[model samples]
Target: MIAAAALIAAAPAVLALDGTPGQGAALTGSVPPGTTLQLDGQPVAVAADGRFLIAFDRDAGPAATLLATLPDGQRIVRPLSVAPRAWRIERLPTLPRISQPSAEFRRRRAPELAQIEAARDMATDAQGWRQRFVWPVRGRISGLFGSQRIYAGEPGAYHSGVDVARPTGTPVAAPADGVVILAAAAPFTLEGNLLMIDHGMGLNSAFLHLSRIDVKPGDQVRQGQVVGAIGATGRATGPHLHWGMKWHDARIDPLLLAGPMTP
Candidate 1:
């Protein structure tokens, strides 16, 4: 992994790229204010403070591109390298046809999908992502990001978050400072009692399978503040907490941000 302070000389502009370049990496970087940043020919949002986040998809290519255009019209292009990762796949014979959602399930999921997209689309310059992230709950890890299940020779959807095995009613805290954007107590079809928080600049965290939610939309929460309790709601088979994170619409690894968990 490259250091965050690595400087790249691009003739007219010296761009400093923070964070590693890999799958599920939410890299932060800075350019001159008013500079337009582009990733893979797509326009990327830059905060007023000159901070921008670059997100790598789980199956991103081995190489990527970054284009920066200064206020004076000078254009800088830098190619990026992305590292690949192996995923965990579980084979199940008794698994239902999860890959195909029923009409009723799809109808009920439309609004939920919209809400999740809305929460992730939020962008602010508060730098909440700059703070270190801590584990929301401590327990044995049962699932991981990008892991998938195979049923009857068909691959199902990848696991969207990391699952921590814990007893019911275990307190779940905010991994970092953020404003609550979603708090649904009733168990959904899949996510169960889902809660989402926006940590400024399109970075967000989601807690799933919660038994109870204490925070509501628009509520400010500090790091380590209790927001919910663990449970086996939704499709979970046992009491656990699913912690998912994202930068904009790109799904990132929460374990990467939280670092190693202590026993």
Candidate 2:
């Protein structure tokens, strides 16, 4: 199995890869032109120039396989090792509450989820995925990604994003260049004033609990552009910006892509 940033060449085909290799990690690499790529037997999108991006889910297995079929039909196989991370798991004294979904929640949630899924399914040509990501806001980290609470032996949903504790009306910037996909006209019941941006290559960002959305759908946004304001508009107790990122179906850790928070 190959580790991080390893390159292997087979005859006329060349496969070069580099990035963090672990659960919730996003890896970028390139292969020979006209090469088809796959991760664990799943077809991966390859740009015209042979550049590609792949990410491991938060609960991805320790090992994965990458297959590249060159233009000449030569197959290059790569065994990848995905390292595991220790998430912050808290244990509760009582068992999990088994509650049925409310009728209102079930009604409003279906459309909201449909919109999000449609946005993610869009294959945009934005090149933001190649750029270094920046923090949408700089402040005290109120919540961490991949943190979960366990009730008895049952595990609850882990935190999907990193939260920045900021005051209401605090302007939040776009982490990278992208086209706005979903700028909710009205607040969502749970996400509030939500804004989603597609950075291309199956990588996207979602800003939750926003007070205002400055951009509209299909608008091109650059890195550091003001896109929204922080607020406690949904099920939040306080005003903060929840910045979540996903690569296709994989929920990636934004901190891993954006690095340490800066002023």
Candidate 3:
């Protein structure tokens, strides 16, 4: 299966790439140590061992380029084709419900947004991005990433995370080793009790609508460690864990990183 996802041509002498190059996919690659890497002209972080990670967003264009500049002035370019997926789109005949935000909501939401932005922007030394991710909780998938609904010709925001339906208080585990960046002390307007973890390499995970948070900011958590509990907090309708991930600004599909869930 991995071999199938790794669609690449001849690897250059200075670099090699692997993993899926599809939209919403993450690719891991390596280059000669000291090689500088860039994706679409943006500098990408390369570990001391030459390893690096890059990803395509769900709405990414058909192609991108990776440029590696070796220490000896050698340059290698790899053009990537991003395979697209058909998103699940639901259309309803009713008019979209638009409501004016309350003054209180507007006042409170600013700080919440600021806190979330600050958490995701933090850089940490955690190496969990190199590890294979695991399911935080196993259950029926309630919501899918990139799925959207439309009402009266108006398109709603696409789902940003994969939601697993579970009973309230069910423990949620860390998908990979990470440093806790934000463990919300109270429920936010939409996220409830949110927890953010930095897995390094510009990749991070956000667990939302949690009933309880077992970890706190600056805590180092390992894969499968309990970090929170499932809940119907925030704007959710029922108990579930909203597991969202991002590689820099690109929203990621947790189902891709963790693979098939098993008992």
Candidate 4:
């Protein structure tokens, strides 16, 4: 917990960023210590030291307003400026069958989907998750958010989250205070042994390709608390942790939610 006066004293005179509305803009700014950031109504966890980053969703429309409220009752509002980009949308001329899962795979994927849905629906009354977030795992960043992806010679979906490539069996910690909404081995063709945590107000963190799960459903975890270990499960190429984050159903960059991650 932080004092409101300390938060007010640390807040910037006015929040400012270099970007346009509706475009996938990269926003870098500072909040007062223990303040919470809301961009287009989604919660962004700040660091204890007041540093934070947030990126607009690709589908975010133009003319979005960002709201940052200090614990002391000070508020900063900034209008987003988004630049236009030409997007290439096309239907594959010849889709591969391997891209589609087999019948047996589909049978096993149902429970995984159920677990994910349950995690997404987890509710909490406490708002302590608004505090500063920490890195769950520190390692080489093997992937980024919103990058175009190619799977097995077919154009796949865009990378919706950041990937921290740590060695196999390295412990993965909770990035923020949250309840373990789902903790079980999943059979998804892509994400195996998945774990999702709800940090309240629709902000959730997902750990994929886990080798071992340390927490269980409905368990409360704090920042830097070990939750699982990394592994080459599911469709992974090697041993690593695919850390993803979502605000409601909108996928956001986890890297944007924290300061520069160091291995």
| Candidate that scores best on TM-score | 3
Q: What total of clashing residue pairs does each candidate reach?
A: 1, 0, 0, 6
Over 114-189, each residue of candidate 3 has an lDDT whose tens digit, in order, gives 9999998999999999999999999999999999888888888899989999999999999999999999999999
Q: lDDT per residue, candidate 4, 154-195, as tens digits? A: 666777677888889999989888888887754356787888
Q: In model 1, which range of ten residues has the least summed lDDT?
A: 1-10
Task: For each candidate, give its TM-score against the true structure.
Answer: 0.88, 0.93, 0.94, 0.68
Evaluate all candidate structures by whole-model CA lDDT and list the values in order. 0.83, 0.90, 0.90, 0.70
Ranking by TM-score: 3, 2, 1, 4
Show model 4 residue runs off by greater than 4 Å.
1-56, 65-98, 126-128, 150-155, 185-187
lDDT of 2 at 38: 88
lDDT, model 2, position 232 = 92
Candidate 1 Cα misplacement greater than 4 A, ranges:
1-13, 91-103, 124-126
RMSD of each: 4.8, 3.8, 5.0, 7.9
User: For candidate 1, what is the lDDT?
Assistant: 0.83
